[model samples]
Target: MKITRKDFLRLSGLSFLAGGAMEAARAIAGRSSAATESQSTPVAQSVRWGMVVDLRRCQKEKGCTACTDACDAAHNVPRLADPQHQVNWIWTQPYETVFPFIQNGYAEQSDAGIPVPLLCNHCASPPCVHVCPTQATWKRADGIVMMDWHRCIGCRYCMAACPYGSRSFNWVDPRPAIAHINPDFPTRSKGVVEKCNFCEERLANGLKPSCVDACPQKALVFGNLADPNSEPRQLLRQRFAVQREPELGTGPSVYYLV
Candidate 1:
């Protein structure tokens, strides 16, 4: 059997779990988990960050890539020419693909072809975090699912655990592929996983997510979902919204207002 490059990389990632490195990785994960719990406070747990995408508004501008472009620029996400190695923080999926449960005939005709932006849902119970043996991916106190690139073992367990297909593996060194690097953000090396973090770095600086900020239609709304007065919460109350695979019980924080 001829092993492809991708298969070789996958095998290498699995082989990395052997020997002294695996034990050291486990030790680091244990210590980090302990510190995370000890550092959590009431204020940190009070705010739950969420995003609401108004599909009605978003579809008005057909083929617009502003949100995705802004996200890539801000995060330094590589723009690899090959589809196999493309790295994206935010991108679009056909409406039908996003909501397979919606089988109404009229609804399908009207909305099925629309391009709905997709990203990590930042679930209340993130399977990616739970499956990461290195503690590389963990849910933050504020409900953000974070990736600690340094501790990532590239085992791809988190990728398998995420049903949304939100995670991307660094099949090669990503820096060189980036058209223009964003110095504010760090780049990833080969053998690591990456994904949208809800722009936690920007949030810490008191700014909205780059994607939300760049949406010309003002389709993306971000705020603390715990606050009833927040735009996302208010929208959820007034409009009909649905999450990606809500039945899976992951408690996705990203909602789409239909």
Candidate 2:
């Protein structure tokens, strides 16, 4: 009998699966070379998100509510009756309230002094992401931390893990209070933890955050910290700054100028 090249090739191919012998051999030898060859490699995506808060430009005029209003309107956050249950994605913290020492020893006392706008710092080593049992919260490739509301089991472990108290638990449904909702943003359900996304929707659309845009004084600047050419990076380099709870080692993306 004469075997043609095609027939020979076919027989050779079948030889690998000839019997239980090959399977046992492959199992003992570890992953088959063919299986390894077929594996796909992971592709890396780049995103180095960061923020800058220019305190010098921030004015106490209107109590810095512009950023809060812009953020609430954009995200459809509800106004709650009780302070404990209240959900604030981005809120203002009075200078004296946040940093009491700044005014405690100083002879000057003024309520009109500029108050800092507080939000999720979106830390480089976010403890919230680490403590989430459901993997609902995670940091994006672009350095913005995000929450997957659907995947969230409402554990609220992230809340305790965050040192800055950036995470807010949705104690009640927020949709009822939303008179007008922005289609671009999704309203979060009750039971899940939510916080600032750095206006990730806007970022994905190639736009600055609502708070950044709403600032009359342009106090807030958002850009990539990795890029020295970026506005935030340049601003940080030019000015002395501080971050909230630096002792936690979260590597907070937001910087505050005194």
Candidate 3:
């Protein structure tokens, strides 16, 4: 029996997830397939934001909380302690699970705990937008997949449509779970689904995503995938990178270098 990539992601299991912010991102990515989209929009630039994760650098790191903590703090994401209801805007996964399509030697990457940071891919053709009855999740003009929390009906249809299992529902009020509240960030109420928005708010303010800023190992890179001179494009051209579940045709913007 072959343990396929989908099977690997299923086995990886996500126990925690955090709240809202991804709607704006989903709207952008949901508009087109990352590989095919022209990455055009009116209000936004001709930019397609993407990420690159270098396993070699990530391997040297031992702590997984840096990215997660920064994301939570920047976005006011809650720390749901309950295993049944924990929320994660960003988290870690084993290398084997992150790149299950690759075989044999890749397992070595998981030797010292792969702990690859995982988040919403902001796929060019995000399925989350397709299933959204209220257009809560849609692709933005700049090619980010975004979510409108006010528009979401808690249908979880987007969650089911997402092959990456990135979306998290608010089963309870998330305020009490927060250790420190960032007054600038908005909080999510119960019965809403939220995920990483690739820091749309920060981007609007001319800043990088919180996770990218906080990674001490410098394992993560963020840029406009459409720009040939962008860091992400340069890395993709020079290094061997792969996306999670490419077979699903989501055209994820996030790439991983092993």
Best candidate per TM-score, number? 1
Per-residue lDDT tens digits for candidate 2, residues 1-258, read 999999999988788667667778877467446434323222442457788887778753665588888899999888877799888777877676655545656543654345678899988788998788766887776778899988998888999999877888888887787778888778888888889999988887899999999999888998887777899888888898888878778889999877
**Candidate 1 lDDT, tens digit per residue, 53-171?**
99999998989999999999988898887888877789998988878888676778777789989999999888998788877998887889999999999999999999999999988
TM-score of model 1 (CA atoms): 0.84
lDDT of each: 0.90, 0.80, 0.84
TM values, all candidates: 0.84, 0.78, 0.80
- For TM-score, candidate 1 versus 3, the one ahead is 1
TM-score of candidate 2 against the unseen true structure: 0.78
Q: Candidate 3, TM-score vs. the true structure?
A: 0.80
Off by over 4 Å in 2: 1-46, 100-104, 107-113
Best by lDDT: 1
CA RMSD for every model?
Answer: 9.3, 10.9, 15.5
lDDT of 3 by residue, 116-179 (tens): 7899999987889878888788888667788888888998999899998899999999999989
Please identify model 1 stretches exceeding 4 Å from their true place.
1-44
Q: Is candidate 1 or candidate 2 better by lDDT?
A: 1
